[model samples]
Target: MEHLKTFLLKRFRIKDLGDLKYFLGIEFSRSKKGIFMSQRKYALDILQDSGLLGACLDNFPMEQNLKLTPTDGALLHDPTKYRRLVGRLIYLTVTRPDIAYSVRTLSEFMHQPRKPHWDTALRILKYVKGTPGQGLLFPASNNLALKAFCDSDWGGCRATRRSVTGYCVFLGNALISWKSKKQTNVSRSSAEAEYRAMANTCLELTWLRYILQDLKVLQTVPVPLFCDNQAALYIAANPVFHERTKHIEIDCHIVREKLQAGMISPSYVPTRFQLADVFTKALGKDQFVTLRDKLGLHDIHSPT
Candidate 1:
């Protein structure tokens, strides 16, 4: 970059900003082990705006086994406020992926937020308040392997009866991408939901491989994708689809094609080791913290 800057300066004028410290509401810093990224100021502002800056903290964003129904809560007086606040929190998820599941849950009621829904959103803000400085850490290393975990909650949404798909991709030990989204179509079975989530993850892995290729980084090994559902693994590895799986025919084929092509290797993981579960559903505080830590996120100021 320095050499290119010199050559470009000879032809035209440009300014140098040195190394990046902060940009687009995200703070950046370096440590002996790795690079740290956080949205501390942005998160604090959200708490302050919601009058939760001094509020007691919540160890987890949402309650364990928490369920929300559109018809359950009292109608909010101002729907616009709920929309705006949820929008801001969505942006914060760029660095705070730990809150992705909760934000996705809250965003569902944007059209007509109820008092209960707004209360749940406030709970997320409180969770953010407790760990504003916690964020991703990308360590400097030679491990460039691309691996991922894919999981889903079968019909977690009551009103829509739609499954939630979640996956996280890791380049070595650093998390590069993750998503928690409601499937457009309703799945008839848990295996079907898991199969669809695996298909989504396979496509994402393929795209990331192409991006790495564009940067001249070659991935020689087949990407390994871990799924907790044994039935889903069997479906991916099997080419034969039966009566029950007819509902998920397309997804089954997509995953099978990827597996046959050696683009991705599907493996079984136990529920306790499934990192993507945190993204797929509301979790207890103990479980949330364990997986969040596994994502390589920690407070930058905390003692090692």
Candidate 2:
């Protein structure tokens, strides 16, 4: 580290910051157990800017089974505020995967936000207020094996009827990457949706493996990819193709190819233990809390 610093110092004038305490809007704190990250100040600033600092707090970001259509309610008089707030919330999701689904849903309405959509967006703020210091924790561990969970909500979007794909990848116990997104094409069945999600997860895993290889982190064993759908697992393992899966032939090929190459091993995980469920849809408080803990999110400000 000193050799590189000396080389850079000789050519360009630079000052050592010593260690990364904060960058952009993220706050970092370290201990023997692990490094903790949060956006507490950023979150509080957002609440103050939106006049939600004193609003009633919410235990969870969104209601379970809540559906928001494009034409649900009257359009907002000034959508600029809605757009800006949702945009900031989108950035906040970088360290707060707990709110990913809510923010993703709100982002869809940015083009034509309705009153109800604005209200739902504010509800997210209220939830943020409850734990502004909540963030990801990278625990100190020697294990670096990659594990992943992927899920799909078949036809989750009420307006477009598009399935939502959600997946989270962990290096050891630390969450490295996650996403909640709507599929571009409509799926004919739940298995197809799950298969598409597996394909997307496979792509992410493949990229991460390359990154690890560059960092000299050798992966001797194939990474485990957990999915709740048995049919999807069977599809990945099965070599024969059928008419039912013809539409998603490309997606099947992507996952099956990786499986055949021993890059990723697809397995079944029960819905209750599926941590990716929180990203796919709005969950109840109990289930949300359960999965949120499993995601390695910690509130540093909370009493021990």
TM-scores of all candidate predictions against the true structure: 0.97, 0.99
Q: What C-alpha lDDT, on a 0 to 100 scale, does residue 105 get in candidate 1? A: 91
Looking at model 1, residue 193 earns an lDDT score of 91
lDDT of 1 by residue, 1-304 (tens): 8899899889987777887899999999986887889988888888888888889989999999899988896899989999999999999999988889999999998888999889889999988888998888898774988999999999999988999999999999999999999999989889989989999999899999999999988888889899999988888777777898888888888888878888898888999899999999999989899999898887976668
Worst 10 residues of 2 by lDDT: 136-145
* lDDT of all predictions: 0.90, 0.94
Give candidate 2 misplaced runs (Cα > 4 Å). Answer: none
Report the lDDT tens digits of candidate 2 across residue range 43-66.
Answer: 999999999888999999999988
Q: Which sections of candidate 1 miss by over 4 Å?
A: 10-13
lDDT of 2 at 100: 99
TM-score of 1: 0.97
* Winning model by TM-score: 2
Query: At residue 47, what lDDT does model 2 achieve?
Result: 99
